[model samples]
Target: MSEARPYGFEVVRLARLEARLVVYDWAWARDNAERVTENWRRRVAGQPALFDGPVLLACDCAIVGEVCRLSLFETTYARFLAYRDGGSPDGHVANAFAAIVPWSADGAVLLGRMGAHTANAGQIYFPCGTPDPGDVRGESVDFSGSAGRELLEETGLDLPEDAPEDWVCLRGEGQLAFLRPVRFSDAAATLIDRMETHAIREDEPELSGIVAVRSAADIDAAMPGFVRAYLASAFDAGARARRRRT
Candidate 1:
């Protein structure tokens, strides 16, 4: 059998409620797990000094007609693990980005599923802006651009030009704030209408589908506790703004 090609990030599909990722790997990740973990740790440390903790690397290999390797490196210390190299004084960050938690009208949240090219499919959130390897520092995809890019790349959604602009950045208590944008008020409704009337292409073999949750409680119920907490803060900020206007 031919060796699997090196892995690269790619969006397989986009659903009204979630986006799917496909991370491909033919060999058992275990062979390079430790080295990969250490390399990531070193990378993290070299970035701006932030949190502290042992970075935990978790991964899985799925064999479904094809072999795929999934890996995750997580740490509780927000500073050490969550900080990106772009924000660091020294250069060297991964050329990867994610849409953290995307929301639809009626407060339904979108999540992504893992596929042949993904580490793990999880809930969708705010679309984060990031720079390519050669791009200038701080030059990232704006909120609108990121959302549109993610929607198109993941789900092939040609979102209308009149998408909403309610968003927030989830930085540390006071360190740096990462922006999260909501493209539409009725994103779920818009998505449902699209799915029902639109024709979906199956050319991509990586993404599975997007999943939606109706309420904050529903999101918490479907996702990990930590994820729930992270999402809550974003939603809470929006709620607070709404309350102020009222």
Candidate 2:
């Protein structure tokens, strides 16, 4: 297994997910409750639709062989928003979520632009959200289920059970985005059409629209740093694969 970088994004492969319940005690959120509440108030004032729902945060992460273990604890989305917007003043904890990488048959992948009503409006990335109570099973979290639900909610694509299930971990700026690549039989354009149709019917769709990404060149500033890093790495991998095939 390769080592993850300290600052910029590093793609690390994983064979399994393991999480254990931890006691809730985020000192930053406690010490700054007044400030955090004020920030959330202002945020909701701007985006009234944002939800302060249940969410999870990783207190610690460690990779052992093919296993990726995390110490997780539940928290409110409002605290998460404040922590994220405050540049993550609490260095002890970080946001860890899973999302599916929609790789199509035509060598392009799909990303969605978050709608204006969403917390991350205008951002383009794979369909994923922070793990919530629904992801919890016993003392651990079901990351695969979490990723699948997000994809279906945003893209309306129900990935087949037999699709390729390779996993990659994107680590950067205290955020861990677990990406599971699902190769779709449909071409990128065809998949986009399907997603558009789905969006047309949603009362308030999570994604404004889908974009096809062939390489890092398609990445834009709207994409989060971790997402851009994955794109760059994905593009480089594609180039290397092409070179070897020739």
Top TM-score hit: 2
Q: Which portions of model 1 show Cα errors greater than 4 Å?
A: 1-34, 37-102, 122-144, 159-167, 172-179, 183-190, 193-200, 221-227, 237-246
| Global Cα lDDT for candidate 2 | 0.87
- Cα displacement (angstroms), candidate 1, residue 226, comes to 7.5
What tens-digit string does per-residue lDDT give for candidate 2 at 87-158?
A: 887688889999999989998989999999999999998999999888888887888889999999999999
C-alpha local distance difference test of each model: 0.38, 0.87
TM-score of 2: 0.95
Q: Model 1 — which ten-residue stretch has the worst lDDT?
A: 4-13
- Please give the RMSD of candidate 2 to the true structure: 1.6
lDDT by residue for model 1 over 1-246, one digit each (tens)?
A: 112111211112111121112233323233444544564576555543323443322222222222222222332233223333223222221123334355576777665443443322343333232312222113222324544565556554565566544333222221222233444456686765553332245454224555666545555443433345445554555688999999
lDDT of 1 at 148: 59
* TM of each candidate vs. truth: 0.44, 0.95
For candidate 1, report its TM-score.
Answer: 0.44
Residue 90 displacement in candidate 2 (angstroms): 2.0
Off by over 4 Å in 2: 3-7
